[model samples]
Each structure stands twice: as structure tokens, then as C-alpha cells.
Target: MRAGLATLVLLALAGYVFLHYQTGGARAPECVVTGTGTGEPYRLQPQQAANAATIQAVASSRGLPERAVTIALATAMQESSLRNIDYGDRDSLGLFQQRPSMGWGSEEEIMDPVYAAGQFYDHLVQIPGYTTMPLTEAAQMVQRSAFPDEYAKHEPQAAMLTAALTGRAAASLYCTSAMDPAPGDPGEIRGRLAHEFGDAVRTDHSGRDITVEVPEPELSPQGWEVAHWAVAHAAEFGVERIVHRDRVWEARRSVKGWQAAREQDTADGLLITVAP
Candidate 1:
């Protein structure tokens, strides 16, 4: 009887271990969706979506890959649904729900989505072997969640959001906010670009918008610099279109003939299309 009982116990233990390994030692139910089941198309709140774009732009400016962006987005989605809310578990606050009491920063600084996301990424990149691990494990390592495995469930949607926002895959990230155009200061834009890409920047003014063109040799090295600068100044200049070689990118503004094909390598250099 004792021998038979021992055999059964061993088999049970083996089965449990197998199941644990198979499920990556995390509970499967933790990742299950619990939100509304209405199959209607749902959009994120305007400010939340804008915050996602800002995070993506900041990450891209740092030259981080799409995976990092996805991880950051997923973490943010899980935390605050990409909203820069001013509350969370205990004293935790901001987009990542980081506690200001825990050396993250002051309450106001932590509430800033860009600052919070940047700090989160700064810490995330430090985890050893984080890139190779599963998304849930990596995120869990960073967040130490009570339900550690839940972060995995958001990976697919997070990947889609990152692609859409980063301009990696072709998809529009639209927001329904009222159009408020702010013409960016040309001098500031030029000074910033010159600081980043040296003095290779050429400046021109077309109506109310200022187009800053960079040289061809600097294009490869300075693409991100220019791209980030443009995105940062997007709200300003009521930026209608961003035209690079063979690609004409449009933003929210009234732009007529802004999509014209470009064959003129004008004296300035490569064309950077902006709007009034």
C-alpha cells in the first residue's frame, strides 16, 4: 500500500511540474480579458492616444527598435491604458503608475507621460537578458506585478499600436481633437537641428511655414533627428505635410498641392515639406 501511494505521488508531482513548465510557471487565467465584450470599434481617449504617440516619438528619437516601443506601450497599456492619470495603487501615479515616493520623481514630473515613459524604458533596458525573455516575464521583472503574467495578454495589441504609431507599418493614427494650428518658431527649429546634425541644415520659409532642408550626406545620419524635430513641431506650423524623397506624409491641416511630385533638388538641399 505504501509503495503504491509513493508511485502515485511521484506521478502527480511530475505532472504538476510539466504543467508549470508548459505554462511558463505563470497562471494562465491572469491574462484573460475582463473588459467589455462589445465588438464595436473602440478608440482610446484622445489624450491617451496622443500620449502613446509622444512615447513612440521619444523612443524613436533614442533610436530604440520597435520591440522596445511595443514593450513600453504594453506596459503603459497595462498600467494606465496609456493615460497620464494622476492616481494608481497606493501613492503610485502617472502613466506607468510609478510612485513619486520611490525615487521615480516628484508628483508633477511623474505625471508627465513622456518623462515617465522615458524613465520606464531607462530601467527596462537595464534588466539583464530582458530582450530574450518573454514579454510578460520581462515586464514582470520590471514591474513585479501581483499578477505577473497578465502583461503577455497585451503583447499582440501593443505590437499593433506600436507599428501604427511608429510609421513602421502603414496605418494612420488619428485623433479627433479640434484642429489648433501653432506656427513653430523657425529660428528655434533651425538652432535645434543645427545642434543635433551640425551646421548642415538649410532653412527656407514658404508662407507661414519654415522648411529646414538637410544635405544628402547627412540624410542617413540625420533622418531620425529631422523626423523627431518634425513630429515635435507638428502641432505648430499647423504642419500639413512632411515630404521626403519618394514619400509625401500628411498631417492634420489644409494643404493644397502639398502632394506635388518633387524633381527639384533646390539650392537648399533635400526638401522638407511643412505647412502654414
Candidate 2:
């Protein structure tokens, strides 16, 4: 009887171990990538990826972070796959497919990807806890979609896109423009960054077409925040190289350029060197 009882005890222990291994020892849902890509899987088409660039540009222009951009992209992906469609559940139209009767905007503006994205971000930022909440929850609050849970399905891909577009991660983003020539002129990139970071930016007469120098601020919480913001906007400036503390981060494009190293100067200032 003693030996039989001991065997039962060992069997129970094994079962527990198996269950723990299978479930990661908690009831938390496993992080699953649900689409085609190897990392941060999403179900958007090539055109949608281009639309995402427009969305990122709009968010960057508003001084919003990658998190906000991600939320907007996820919301749009669930709503219209980033396409500026002219139809919706009723009279809805455009990228958001917002109903004009609902006070969204005129049909022409709604179909404009940049305008649509900007309006979406505007509404999203006004939410009380949007910045800290889960992407799906924050998006639902703004969209108030009847199928609220559908937004959750796009989080993985949205995260991947944000990390790549914001330069937080390397080579995680790519897109094909609607026109082979690319939609917006590259000059708009610099203009938008300047608008967000401020007119304090300085230019060198060295004939380097697209570079700006930002004075390192005294080390403080605000300084760090601004420095981080500059780094985040690096992609918007067509910056492919950043030089600070004798280190360089270079990429073939602005999105790739964001991997540059961040160095803190002795004066409590953070120097953000970027490639134009």
C-alpha cells in the first residue's frame, strides 16, 4: 500500500509539471503571431503598408509616440485594412470609414489618408488612459466599434510595424508606395519633424541637404523625454546615420536609421546624432 501510494504521488507531480510546461504555469493567454510574417504577424496588403507610412507620418507630426501610431494602425487595420474605402457598415467611408452624418468630416477629407489618420489620432489621444492601456482597449474606446474584440487581432502586427517605423527595432518595417515615385516629397519629412521637435533646430552650411543639430539639454526628466522624442522622430527626417560618442547607426532608410546609439554627455545632456 505504501509503494502504491508513492507511485500515485509521483504520477500527480508529473501531471502537474506537464500542465505547467504546456500553459507556461499561468492562465495568461500566450502571445501568438497570427498572420504571414515571421515576427509581429499581420494581415494587411501592400497598399495598406503604404497607408501605414502615411499614418506614422501624421502621428509623428502630432508629437505622438510609437504607441499611439500602433494603436491607430491596429484600429485602421481592423476597420479598413488601411485602405481609404468609400463604403462602410452604412454611410461610412474612407480609411476610418467614419460616417459623415456622424460628424467625421467631408467625403473628400475622409478619403485623404493623411487627414483620416490625423483625425483618428486626435480622437485617440483624447482618451483618458489611452497611452497606458492595451492597444485594443485604447482603440476600442475611440472607435466604439460594435465588434470591439476584433481590434485585438491586429495588435501583434501593429506592434511590429510601430517598432520598425519608429526606429525602436531594426528592419522590422517595409512598404511599397502607391505610385512608384513615392507619394509625398522627402522635404515634407524634415518639415514635419521640425514642427514636432520645435524651431530650435539648427542647420549647418556644410551643404548636407537634410541634417539638423539639436542642443543637448541639461539632464532632467524633460531633457530625457525630448531626447527620446528626437530619436523617435529620426525616421521622419530621412536620417540614415547618427553620430554620437564616436558611434554610428546607419540604415538604408529613415526607418532603419533609428537604431543609432544614444550617449549621455558629461553635462547631463543627451546628444542625439542622426544621419540626414
Stretches of candidate 1 off by over 4 Å are 1-45, 170-207, 210-238, 246-276
Candidate 2 TM-score, true structure as reference = 0.54
Judging by lDDT against the true structure, name the best candidate: 1
Q: What is the per-residue lDDT of model 1 for residues 137-206, given as tens digits with 9 covering 90 to 100? A: 8887777778887788888777766655554432133322113345445555555444433444456665
Minimum summed lDDT over a 10-residue window in model 2 is located at 175-184
- How far residue 185's Cα lies from its native spot in candidate 1, in Å, is 5.5
Ten contiguous residues minimizing lDDT sum, candidate 1: 27-36
Question: TM-score, each model?
Answer: 0.60, 0.54
- lDDT measured at residue 100 in model 2 versus the true structure, 0 to 100: 79
lDDT of 2 by residue, 104-200 (tens): 8888888877778878887887899888888878988888889889988888778776665554543333321111122222365455545443443
What stretches of model 2 exceed 4 Å from their correct place? Answer: 1-44, 175-276
Error of 1 at 35 (Å): 23
Q: How close is candidate 1 to the true structure, as a TM-score?
A: 0.60
CA RMSD, predictions in order: 18.3, 13.8
